[model samples]
Target chain A: MDIYDILFWVLSAIAVSCALGVILSRNPVNSVMFLILTFFAISGHYILMNAQFLAIVNVIVYAGAIMVLFLFVIMLMNLNADVEPQKGQLVQLAGVISGGVLFLVVLAGIKSARPVTIDKAASDIGLITNLGKVLFTKYVLPFEISSVLFLSAMIGAIVIGKKEDAKPIAPRDEEL
Target chain B: MPVNSTHYLFLSLLLFSIGIMGALMRRNAIIIFMCIELMLNAVNLLLVAFSKIYGDADAQLFVFFIMVVAAAEVAVGLAIIVMMYRKVHSVDINILNRLKH
Candidate 1:
């Protein structure tokens, strides 16, 4: 195998193993840590694909910020491995069937994909430069919409995270 | 033949399947959240591989959007998980079957 092949195998193994660890870890904090590792490995794969900006952003946004928030929640709640509900055989069977369908569909998709020759030497970046153009110019509406979504999510999270009060005031526009 | 785009496709498929397995089988809410992240990463891999194959940056850009969405999802999801924990004291999803209200 060539260098590319070896790197692919190694990176993918790290990604898959960390992903498994995310699911298998009993503690939520540890699971989030594993999830961060999974994101880091995937970032490495993006670097391998020559998307350096994407790799950096992936690490910063995912492994750095989002997962830190997750850890904060886990710790704030004081979740421990003990006192968690146990799994049942039915859950495993459901998992098996669901995973089986996902596997089948993906395998069929791979079989059906038409062969396409990839060009690796395209402009070293469409990352920060051209991607900004696409996001702002071509997909401007969607970008704005995403901002709105995030704003709403920020509000919703604030609302949810607030300490419970005696009564929450309903909006004026609600039914009188 | 040596491995190529097809192999990447298979790898992504397997990862997606594994994510599905985790989502379906795991009783913990945190584990389900992680599985969803894995599925998103699997899609990102497929997107990057296709971007390489097609000589396009659009897929890479989409990957950026996916990362953004995944971040938002985890933020909101964890917040809700915290809410659940406040009421129930456990994040294990298996015991959460009182949804008939």
Candidate 2:
């Protein structure tokens, strides 16, 4: 295998391993860290696919913004090993079995499908310029709708997360 | 040999499977949320790979939209988790069953 193949294997391995770490780690903080590592590896894959814009965005949005949010929640909750509930061994086994079965099915399907050769030349499809053109021209409606979705999410989060107002209980009239 | 779409597809499938396992097995609500994010990222990887293969920007654009939705989801999901923590004093999903009462 050449450098491209080598890199692909390495990045995918990192991603998969880190993903396992995220699930297996007992501490929530560690899980978040592993998730960040997984995101980084995924960003590397995006780079390999020559999707430079997505690579950058993956790092910035996922690792930067979303992970920090996860970390914040974990820290705010002060989660630790003791408080985390343990799942039954049988359930865990079932989860593993199902996941493995799905993976095998997907692998088999991909292996059986006729391989289509795509042009390897550096394509500008992933570039910001081309992406921006399409985003504004073709997908402008969904783009605006997504903004609205974000706005509603922001409002919902704030409304749900705000501390409840503490009202003093009034004394009973009979007691007076 | 040059890397092809199959390789990328395999990698994404692996990641997505891992994510499914995590979501199924993990008890912590936060970790489960992280697993969901992992699944989303796996999907994003597949979309980018397919975009490269198909020589179109549409799939990549979908990736962008997916990222947007993921961010919004995190915001709302984490808020709900936090709210749950305040009431229950834990992030364990098992404890949430009591909420039915």
Candidate 3:
């Protein structure tokens, strides 16, 4: 066993455990924190893959920006208290079944992946800037459309979350 | 002691399924967002692993775009969660089924 082996095991273990914690933790704040740890661990894996740009961006976007937003919303919502664990027995059973099926499908796919030949031309240039070039020259249309979609989604979110009249969104039957 | 890519893939599959379970079963909207992040991270890991094994950089670049989208998602999703909390006083998602009509 070499350093690479040890590093792989340790980081993979941390990522998997923290991801599980994100799902299992009852406190939303705790769950968000676990998610942060998971992101950090994943960034480490990216580093191992020799993708330094992706590593930094992964940490910055997912860990620094997105997770902080999650923390703020969780704190703002006051979900830090001892809210009863959601008794999602029926939904959970169904989730487990589906999750199992999906995992099997993915595992089978992974088992069959062929190592295709790499193009020497692609690796001759550094990807950080090359990707930008591609995005502008080749992928620009999809890029522009996604940004528009994001803008519309942002508008929809603002509209959906706007301050309301007397009624809570939760109907009476499901209200706890 | 070098672990193969299959090891990482199986682990990723487990993490992805866990994320799915959280998204499906969690009543707290915040946790659901985190689970989605988990799933994205799993996919990102797979992309990078494939990028390494194939010696390609395009997937890594694609991951960069994905990170941007995920961040945008969080900004919007957090805003919505805060709004929902203000209106409902709790983030219990089961309470959100009222919109199903």
Candidate 4:
């Protein structure tokens, strides 16, 4: 096996185990930590695939931003392992079984598919320069739309989280 | 054997299944939300792999869009969760069963 293969295996193992840790950890904080590790492992995979921009973005956005948001919410709620609710043993078992069955079904379905080998050499398409060109020239509309989406999401969160006042409104003389 | 598209496929599938299991097994709303993130990451990994395989940048760009949407989703979702907690004083989704009544 070459270095890429070894690196791929190492990252894959780390990713899978950390993903399990995310699910199995009792504490929400522990789960968030594990998820961060999992995201890092995935980012490593992105780098290995020569997607430099994606790798950086994955680290900055997923591991850095989104996970911190999760941790903040968990801390805001002050959740602890002792108070964490869990599914019953039977339900947990069923969940595991169903997930395994789905995995097996998909695995079997893809078993016969052709395995296209990736070029181990570097590709320039994933570079920031090329990606920016494509984004601004071809994908500019969607990019702007996403900014709008972000604005709406921000507004929605504020509206939803705002507390309602207890005082009732009095009828106006004009309305009367 | 050298790393190929199939290997990445397997990895992504395994991750996705684990995410599904987590979502199904967890009763905490935040944990469920994290599991959904895990599943989304799995799909992102797969998309990146395919992008490499086809020598295309579109899939990676798609992954970017997915991240954007995920961020927006997390913001709105966590706000809802916090609102729920404020109202019911618990993040346990079982408490939401009262909505059925």
lDDT of 3 by residue, A1-176 (tens): 66666777899899988988888877777887888899888888877767777888888777887778777776766668867566658878888788888888877887886544322222432346766786688778878877887798678777776667555566658655
lDDT of each: 0.78, 0.88, 0.76, 0.93
Quote the B-chain TM-score, candidate 3: 0.91
**Strongest candidate by DockQ:** 4
Q: Give the per-residue lDDT digits (tens) of candidate 2, residues A101-173.
A: 9999889888876665646667777889999999999999999999999999999999999887554667769
Summarize candidate 1's per-residue lDDT along B1-101 as a digit string, tens digits.
Answer: 44478877887887888888888887878778878878888899889888777667789888888887777777778878887887777787755788622
Displacement of the residue B55 alpha carbon in candidate 2, Å: 0.8
Ranking by TM-score: 4, 2, 1, 3
Evaluation by DockQ, superior candidate among 2 and 3: 2
Clashes of each: 0, 0, 1, 0
lDDT of 3 by residue, B1-101 (tens): 24666766777788888899888877777777788888888888888877776776667767767876877677778777777677767777777889632
Runs of candidate 4 exceeding 4 Å displacement: A166-176
Query: Candidate 4 DockQ score?
Result: 0.86
Look at candidate 4 and give me any clashing residue pairs.
none
- TM-score of chain A in every predicted structure: 0.84, 0.89, 0.74, 0.92
How does residue B78 of candidate 4 score in lDDT? 94
Superior candidate under TM-score, 2 versus 4: 4
TM-score of each: 0.88, 0.93, 0.82, 0.95
> Residues A106-143, candidate 4, lDDT per residue (tens digit)?
99999998999989888998999989988888899999
- lDDT, candidate 3, residue A125? 29
Instruction: Give the TM-score, chain B only, in order for the candidates.
Output: 0.94, 0.95, 0.91, 0.96
